[model samples]
Target: MMSSVINALSVDIEDWFQVGAFESTLDRADWPSFEHRVERNTDAVLAMFDDAGAKGTFFTLAWVAERYPALIRRIVAAGHELASHGYDHQRVFTLSAEAFRADLRKSRRLLEDAGGVAVTGYRAPSFSIDQQTPWAHAVLAEEGYAYSSSVAPVRHDHYGWAGSPRFGWRPVDGSGLLELPVTTARLAGRTLAAGGGGFFRMLPYEFSRWAVRQVNAEGHPAVLYFHPWEIDPGQPRVPNAPLRSKVRHYANLSAMEGKLRRLLRDFRWGRVDALVEGMTA
Candidate 1:
């Protein structure tokens, strides 16, 4: 039987240099010195999505939106949702409640104003909303965000809220916001990332494909994400990073776009706003 579940295909709108992996190596102040490749790369992805007749949410950086307003508008013009990735690409856990709230409010306002859409979604940088930051969900709700795709639910050194739900839910303690975690598949009682970013690049396309299918078979939408840089294998490569960081950022760059195209063709996709339509509160 054809699965009725519609999966989310999302793009994080930040320049290659703005990725959290490179944050220690490059400061926000130095971001201007490095050439940014997000606009051109996102245009390419937008073209591919246009060709596939696909629409997905874009969790965009406020810095990118402030500088490249037209790109965010183009994303909305293409019929995708516009959401916040916070200003400056800072992680939720790194900031205090007041600081996090300020960042969240500012970024949401900027995204909505610049993109000409009601920005209702957020995804913390590096999926860093975890046990350390229980206040993250409350702030998201208080600041008027309707949903967040900010938890990975798997354990990792940098991020991931281990043992969290794989699907969507409002926090028991939080007031209004909902959580749409990144897609994951359980095997032998361990939760493995289903698809997107480094995982998508590192895994065989077949594994990524099967993982999302398994989620859809369970009648839930799979929330998958990627970045504009993932498709740009020709992008300028940064030098002298830690070996692991370099591997995670650059692995299988040439093959990323093709896999994304296949995923688009193989399944049904749409904006996150649509993905939650008729969803229970």
Candidate 2:
């Protein structure tokens, strides 16, 4: 049976070449040279959501919005919440406090201008906000963001702020801004990632379904996310990239759409904004 609880679904609006995995190999200056596939993949995602009658959030990159203004408008028109995924998908810990704020401001202005909606939520690129970036939540609050989904509560070489609260909490003292960590489930004394990403693509669909059910049974909404590129197997291959990056990026592209459809039908999916409202209320 499908869970009655509404879990938060999110799509990180980015292209395949723009991923952190290809950063070292692909220069940001040459992003325009690559074939842009985000629009087609994102449109496919929107159609998937429409078919399932589900609503979710699109954490958009201002870089993409600048090039694809019509795509941003299409997302808004489909009733999905629009949020920021930073100006160009820079890791939060990589930038100084002032630079981070500037990135946030730039992203918000572009997204709002392109989509014609108030952008309140944010998801750090690559889930990069952690203890080292203590000023992150404060910066977010100062920038007028109401909430952020930037922390992943699992250990990983690339990014993860392990031991953080599994659900939402005010990361900064006295700030109303909420930091909603990606969903995680405890299994046999070990914490496992229940949220989406490479793990979702690499692992079996049944495991993800089980994880969501476990989290829902505990009475918390599971916050899951994936990139628009995850569903596009035909996306250009980056053969020169590291083997690990290649595996993570291309492991199960063919399976993602089917798994995602099952996930949507198995749970009541909604936008992150609604989940934030409930948590704050």
Candidate 3:
């Protein structure tokens, strides 16, 4: 396949149960016994990226950093970028500004200390920055984050900033923050194809390729993200999960890694920081 120059690639370093859709069914406290879950998931991703000679960002939760310090170090050691995915996987909008600030601070410290790199970027637990939660940007700026990939920009049943610009700085109204929304392909005055999470898992390979091409056609970077759990089909299933979420989380799990391999092979990928640096230069 031909290689296309793509802007940035990112990975969310959370396990299967920690996803936002499953939050009601699975609690953070229940993750301790299954803590090692991320090791295999992350390792598969790292190895895949390694084989494709691609380096990208890994946004990890502080809980993961504190529990698996070695994993964080290993990601850095392997020449990938590290960023914070918050302390717990709580949605930023769900927290008060104080709590959100605390989450960012705690996660920032843990990730920086463990990974031995400056954690300048953050992604909220889910894409929790919607119109109602504009304060999230202020708190993020206050916490010293350089940029965020937290707003999905599509109208999902759970989260979205539907009318937000797909790319560019929003001024955060007051916080002086920059929001780097996830990749979305607009259709008929609305966003239909969003490349991330289970959406990445659910879409066909050719469609994803088309979506990225669409984003690139606009002269902006396509910020693609996925959790490690998306590739791990063997993960223990959460009981009483809503049918839609379960399918979104677990559907076509075995094929995802291969699809990702095709993505890496087809695109020129780099860490988000590298893209930022490349832009400024």
Candidate 4:
């Protein structure tokens, strides 16, 4: 009944120019060179959802919030949920526990201060939760997050927990934090990207629609997510990025916004925390 009431869609609010995929060539310190940030792009995403009368979660980087307080306020003003996407865009698995703690503490503080709400959800940058960092859930619980959308069930070069369930569930480890893994489907004994991130951008619109349907049919809320850049095709490019990263970042660029618009219209979606609380309550 809870799943029937709403769709659980999320947007990772970051600039097209600020992704970690280009970290080697374009350091975060070099962010000053880019004229565009998440302001107008975030507004565009908000407007897209608004046009569909959709309310969803925004897992914003504290890095973005610190630079654009008014934009953070605007997201709240428009009736979306606020959640953390880390303080910097660093991958969680690579950070030691202490370092990760610092990142979360800082992000939680800034996100709550700017957003004017308790941020109960966290999605790691690049979906970087894996077996190597299963302890991150306990850390999240310690940080007061009630749920996480960090784990990607699909295998990828940078992130993914292969064979992890694709739907939301309370952790068997008793961390008291619900794990809402990004959408995935099993194919040939491996996890395939059912939706979200660059995969969501690259896949055919019909395939995404079908994937969500399959996940929902199994009685879990379809947790779809995307980045601001995925829709902002005109943003500056990182030409020095490795060829593979370049292809992933730039593929199907112009067509993404339309696919997202269709998704908002076709699905019954809502904020991530709202759906979780609604389901468990």
Candidate 1 lDDT, 17-104, residue by residue in tens? 9988888887789888888899999899899999999899999999999989899899999999998888998988889999999998
Better by lDDT, candidate 4 or 3: 4
Error of 1 at 159 (Å): 0.9
Ranked by TM-score from best down, the candidates are 2, 1, 4, 3
Question: If both were scored by lDDT, which would come out higher, candidate 1 or candidate 2?
Answer: 2
Best by lDDT: 2
Worst 10 residues of 1 by lDDT: 272-281
Task: Please provide, for model 2 over 111-217, each residue's C-alpha lDDT reduced to its tens digit, 9 standing for 90 to 100.
Answer: 99999999999999999999889898898998888999999988989999889999899987888899988888898998998899888888999888888889899
**RMSD of each predicted structure:** 1.3, 0.7, 1.8, 2.0
> Which residue pairs in model 1 clash with each other?
none
Q: Which ten residues in a row have the lowest lDDT in candidate 4?
A: 1-10
Backbone clash numbers for all candidates listed: 0, 0, 0, 3
Candidate 2 has an lDDT of 0.92
Model 3 regions lying over 4 Å from their true place? 1-4, 173-176
Per-residue accuracy of model 4 over 1-281 as CA lDDT, tens digit each: 22363668899988876676786778777786777657888898989988999999999999899989899999999999999999878999889988999999999899989989988999999888789886788888887788999988876786778788777877647566888888886557656787677878887888888777777777777888898888777778777789988998999989999888888888898899988887668
TM-scores vs. true structure, each candidate: 0.97, 0.99, 0.94, 0.95
The ten-residue window of minimal lDDT in model 3 covers 168-177
lDDT of 2 at 139: 88
lDDT of each: 0.87, 0.92, 0.82, 0.84
Q: Rank the candidates by lDDT, best first.
A: 2, 1, 4, 3
